[model samples]
Target: MGAVATLVAGLGIATATSANAAAGCRVTYANGGQWPGGFTANVTVTNLGDRIDGWRLGWTFASGQAVSQAWNATVTASGTQVTAANVGHNAVLATNGSASFGFNGTWTGSNPAPAAFTLNGVACTGSVGQPSQSPSAPGPGPSASSSPSTPPTTPPPAGDAMAAVAAMQPGWNLGNSLDATGADETSWGNPRITEALLDGIKAQGFKSIRIPVTWGQHQAGAPDYTIDAAYLARVKEVVGWALDDGFYVMVNIHHDSWQWINTMPADRTNVLARYNATWTQLAAAFRDSPAKLVLESVNEPQFTGSSGDAQNATLLNELNTSFRTIVRNSGGGNVTRLLVLPTLHTSADQARLDELTATFTAMNDPNLIATVHYYGYWPFSVNIAGGYRFDATAQKDLTDMFDRISTTFVARGIPVIIGEYGLLGFDRHTGTIEQGEKLKFFELFGAQARANNITTMLWDNGQHFGRTSLQWSDPELIAQIRSSWTTRSGTAASDLVFSARSAAITSKTMTLNLNGTTFTGLRQGSTELVRGTDYTISGDQLTLSAALLTRLSGSRAYGVNATLHVHFSTGVPWRLNLITHDTPVLSAATGTTSAFTIPTTFRGDQLATMEATYADGSNAGPQNWTPFKEFDYTFAPDYTGNVITLKPEFFADVTDGSRVTLKFHFWSGAVVTYYVTKSGTTVTGTLA
Candidate 1:
């Protein structure tokens, strides 16, 4: 017992009038396992009262201890107060029934057992139990009681691979800094990863860490490709930080772009040899390590020039096959160790993924997992700008992508990992979406991924979450991500259903009887509306405010078409189409040919009639005012509406203070005539 302690507290009887006596609860706290810097504890709560509806076990750590991962309960910590709440299924407890929940925690220099525990706001009355030996304790490692033995050579149980994949909680990627362009890790802007940083990540509720290391630049020689001894040692040291704290660790070869592993047939043999050598050494080093440590075959392997070619996909399969063969043949723990394989470019494209599934299924290795990187619909996930929102389209894309993986792989007993998934950053500059949208994305992603048996690893290039400070740059984002993982209950795709209905409104007040019980966020089209500002809700009855109702009437008068989007607090975005009898409208404007400026409010109103009168007083017919010749247009349906362009020829007709009168009919049945005056290439217009 390196830092384990067993402090027994005497049982205290509660008076009849006390809350404890009314509840009739008892709890037993015991240390399950302990290592040098961390330990696992299990708390069993017994309900002796009349039927308990729900349960929450609370305790204060005597030492400076923090919980990392917990199961059978949703655990949260604030300072010294730790609360573990029952999940949906575990909430109900009959008299004399008990439920057990366990957590892995990190402690500083000393580890002390909590003296008291409370269940459901009632003090538990029972003698605290002594620390007992854990039957599921990890094999001998850094601070184990027993000495290390030879690594197990046999494979794990048949379904162990899927089990391990499901066991992996939300993961973080130590990116860019490790997979930098050069051999120096600090060159990528992050400080050297410290044990404190790893502990901080665990304390923040992350159950796994994916360390992406580029070993190609650190290797020497040709055929042998001998990995540098110092580099290997450094990787091992960082990996130990996670392993010592009982975190599921995944290490992989990243950014080794020099090797045309899938292309260049001349170097294919040597590439295979180098891959074999790399895994051989890695498997040997961590052979005796616990099963929590996983080895990924490669990261996003692609052909030199062609990323998504069918031929390259076949080659990627070959490389993955070689990886599995080499690792399994390396003996030691490699025989049973879980290995991650990536699709071509690690793409979420269905065809490439299908090819990977066929190839991997042929390998027939139960310890193998298929991985793909998810940054679906780049504009929403990355490169986010102003007016960005997690709208219906973004929601569908994410849900559909995960559904494909679930049906294609997980349903067939093959597990998948979203190796990397996250918005670019959490700041206003990089992440322009509102905090609500970000939270919605995380919640939907986590809920869907968990339900599909897919693990999501967030990609952080050290900008969003600080590594040195041991604190999150965006605490709200971190909290949202953690909430998704902890609040997840059901494991069915149907749990996240999306539906749309046509709502009828006869008065200023409207009631929306929702299918779901709770509401998370509300939106009208792409514009997210504030709860109190736009509407009010009690149970399922949602009432629109009188002011908002007036605005809706005004929008209807202006022929605006919008939908009311509702998302349940649990998870699921449904739409209510607020159909009105108003016709749609389109608006347009012209800009100077030199630099066109489309009004932000322009709606790309289609041109019904067009005629331009030039400076000479000669009229150009409708044929001469063709839409393309007059201006170019960019339309983002359901997004930013549309943009209009002013053509160069049109600008020339109004040059040198010349005035050109143009009359146009819009699709909305509105007509307007405007005179444009130009000075050089710049043009100005006024309604005539």
Candidate 2:
């Protein structure tokens, strides 16, 4: 929704009169703000006669206005009458007390405030009047008896600000839950959070949790811009749970950065009011809470209508400054509460870091913390533009970023936090980044983060953690990540020890990526393999003897037959899978653009990466910049399904009637060629 240009106030007040009325109620309906086709309305109901429990405010819209979303109340519209019921935390209305709720609605020609209102079906009689002058001011909450009786005790202050933030390392994000935009927190498909889930994360060695929340959907309109008490209470509940469980928690205005905050330059007054109002409420709510809770100013703050970097930086500075002042002046523990400030989009670019450094200089607050997000090298992060491997370029990106942030913040006594760190490719699927390559990225990223003295939080978004099961999808991947926090982990150029079942087995060699750790030895289960007999290490290469491979592959299975553990002097041991496979065979098939599956006989081979190109040798997949399309985005191998699924995302990018060639790269050093053609809605595949 854009900034409202026009405002209409005091159309009419609804008066309800009945003997059965629990108490008399007066409603002030006003069009707080409006744009072209939509407007926001603020509704305040004051109980006049007596106190009422579980109140329901009802009104009839005379101008055919339809409510789309509401906060602080459960609003439902039937024909012209709209009903707003109290939520759990705000269910009681005391005598002469008031409860306020707001909603965004649509109007065609004119928006006139409703004429009459009723409380619990009894008519409320009140004269039409202008809305409150200060609508942004939060209404009177539940009576003192119904609210928390005492403020929480403040936690003792840590000696140093840098030390305080540094203690909050290895954080995990509760992503795609509260940050999801829709009816409620779980609108994004992730399950509602639970204490057990937090316990699972703690068990994994995480010290903190970053809760990203989008408060816009649950907030009322200007001028009061009040947040729903129920929503606020829920956020508080989750934060309190994490804190009580002994995990440092960080909360921030997520997604709203791009939603409404980005329009600050275009609508400074409205945007600033809401921004200030959000922090005011949050600071007030968490004021008495312990210092274990950190308040981040904003998540990936960015301005849409700004002139350039300078203007964007200035706008962001304004937000951060406002956020700090609000929290600090809000009283309670907020006076000394640690605040996190971010660069533009929370980026670690040199210019952005320097800009933030200037802000720190101006603020000169020892309690302040610098924060940024890292998603690895852009290309490798998303497996796009030919960045198919976690190679030199990708590793350099991570180091350069960590080096800059360390020098700018950590080295200067200002603690830093990588608020979110993960591979962008994980969004599509974890498999988007090849497994071995993905592991390498996380291993190096954890070590680098530790070396830089920066707290790192993994952005899970339901991919890393199995929310329902309270387990990780990939145990080895998490194991590697957890190991990197304290020490380096030994990996390899590859994790697979492939042997062709069609031919006699031979000695296989793998270049050990020691990652600064010395290789100890190789083992199977609890038995250590004898050196030279089982494997021999010469320089960086570790070669497995043919005799051992033949013994491991007793029946020449098409898949993994045995597993070998390669230990190192320090960190977690690397696991190598002994697989016996010849090659994969793809059979021709015909399907539609929406769904296309090519039957395949793996014959023991495992798919690694895929390359897609047009007949003219041009890239032919969603990631057009790379002939080697992302692993899972364009094509995925389903060994159990006995087929290769060419995803719709891949077909969506191909030209109609174009013959695209696909090369499936397998772990056994085999690449099979195939061709696919998309003709309108129909698609056909053929063996090449």
Candidate 3:
């Protein structure tokens, strides 16, 4: 979904006239999506020079274009020149840091890029500051960003925080429900919270529930900023139900992190006032609640207009200290309630971990826990930049982050909770990640968290669980995740084994991943296959004899004829599909750029991945780093419709009038080549 297209000729942007004060910078302007007479553009300004407090980016439109709407920054235009200033939360740009903003605009004649850009009156050249020069100014002094001289009165040791968090193993997030930003709780398409939903989760073996609440939209104007009594009551009702259901419940300030809390540095006075008042009301409302309840200071706390990390850390510490004080001083169960604190962005980076470590040590309170979030490796998690597999690179990223948390907090006697964990691509659609790869990610993610003595809460956001049906969207994937919490599951290099129907059947071999487990045997339904005659295992290699494959492919059926279940020494069994297929054929057709559908005879095969390339062998589509464009982004195979649809966004990025070759990879190990050319608004496709 993320695209970086080439700049059109004679429409080049970001040419600086003079170097000015700072070393240099770079500006990237790309078309995210386009349509007739209107389009959306994304701009990224990288600060390659010294750090800047507040920045104003200026550029000139080559064509007669006008900005209609913008986000992440304020865009204003005067004739042909346009300027974008940083917003409250994105005002500071440290060296090597970049600020991204997008806008929708209207264009006539042609949509040419700007010819130049200026950042704070200085031209951008995308160069680093000289080695001899130090940062323009040193970070804030300790006095400006230091902890409180006196720590809050440590709450009486009520219970072990470690035990409390540990008991919250395998948690579920009540996401997109109370956290919805619309008028009411059900504004985000999720059904209203019912006892039946909680019962279903409890029945599914979940020990904890995290309810994220957004109070800003429900509260009245300043001063008291009283949350609608009815909304507060509704939140209380849900919490009470979960508590009664014997689930460890966590409630926190959710979207306010970006709404108001992110403006802390620029408007600390009002921000902290509202923050404290909200928690005060919360403490009073749940004052006498049971000990199973926990309070999180903030959700991924962020700061605005800060010089750098040091100032940001200081500001966060101030908020955490205040939250501890307010809740601890309030009466009843608040005296020793377990509290959760997060680093900047709730990230696992070393600097963020270190900052949180300092906060825990300074608090010196036994009933405190640390929290962070995990979304797996960026590329693979989002299915971009050729990260289509959960290979060693993606595996190591998970290991390294958990290892750092294990050492920084878990090993230091502090319990760390992965407040939210899942694939970022899932936010768009589950199909964004391949089915097997997604399963492996969760399986390993659960095992690693358990090994590190940490707790993880899955971020559902209405994507995983069905509130109306009370059933999981994918039952098998959920089963694998739940199984990983207790033991290891064996998997293979892939879940698919392709057998071409047109060729003679031969012995098929696949390398097993094993994953710290041993393969027991293979089974079809309730019948077991013979060892040497049917299949053989040498080391981690698994071979199915041609005779066994012949029987499975009876009459050389076109499609999956049988599913073989692979049993392991422990945990859930892996499933392997034996699919029989032949080379697919594509029909040449014509259509507009908006919906250019290519007719195809799949011949009992499933789509794997697609690649696009030009004559020069350069990547020819979006995410140009790899020839393989995203699965559902650039082109999608609609098996039911028997057509492969090329999205409009893909054509917007392709060079007009150029022949682009498309490689369609099928699950049956078949590669079908097709070509398409875009000229003006018409597109033509031909099979190779």
lDDT of 3 by residue, 41-97 (tens): 667787887555556687889887866545555566656777776654345566676
Tens-place lDDT per residue, model 1, 1-688, is 0011111122111111112223556776756445444466666677776455556677888876877556567566657777776654345666676665656566667888888877655567753232222222111212212212322212234448876766576688988767776757887778888887776665554667899988888887676778889988998898998887557899988877444454534566777777777877777788877777888878888666554476686667777787787777877777888889887778877887798889877888788888998865554654222114566688898988898888888988888888998865332233333344566677778768766778889988886667776555664455445545644311111111111112334433334323233666666534568877787767655655655645554444322344455655432234443323322233444556565533323232333334466657665322243331221111112324343344554454444666766654443344556566667766676656
Q: List the residue pairs that clash in candidate 3.
A: 25-126
Candidate models: Cα lDDT each? 0.60, 0.79, 0.79
Winner of 1 and 3 under lDDT: 3
Higher TM-score: candidate 1 or 2? Answer: 2
Q: Could you tell me the TM-score of candidate 2?
A: 0.76
Off by over 4 Å in 1: 1-159, 257-266, 306-308, 383-387, 424-429, 488-515, 519-535, 538-688
Q: Give per-model TM-scores.
A: 0.58, 0.76, 0.74
For model 3, the stretches where C-alpha displacement exceeds 4 angstroms are 1-157, 304-306, 613-621, 656-658
Best by TM-score: 2
RMSD of each: 14.0, 20.9, 27.8
- The true-structure Cα RMSD of candidate 1 reads 14.0
Worst-scoring 10-residue span by lDDT in model 3: 137-146
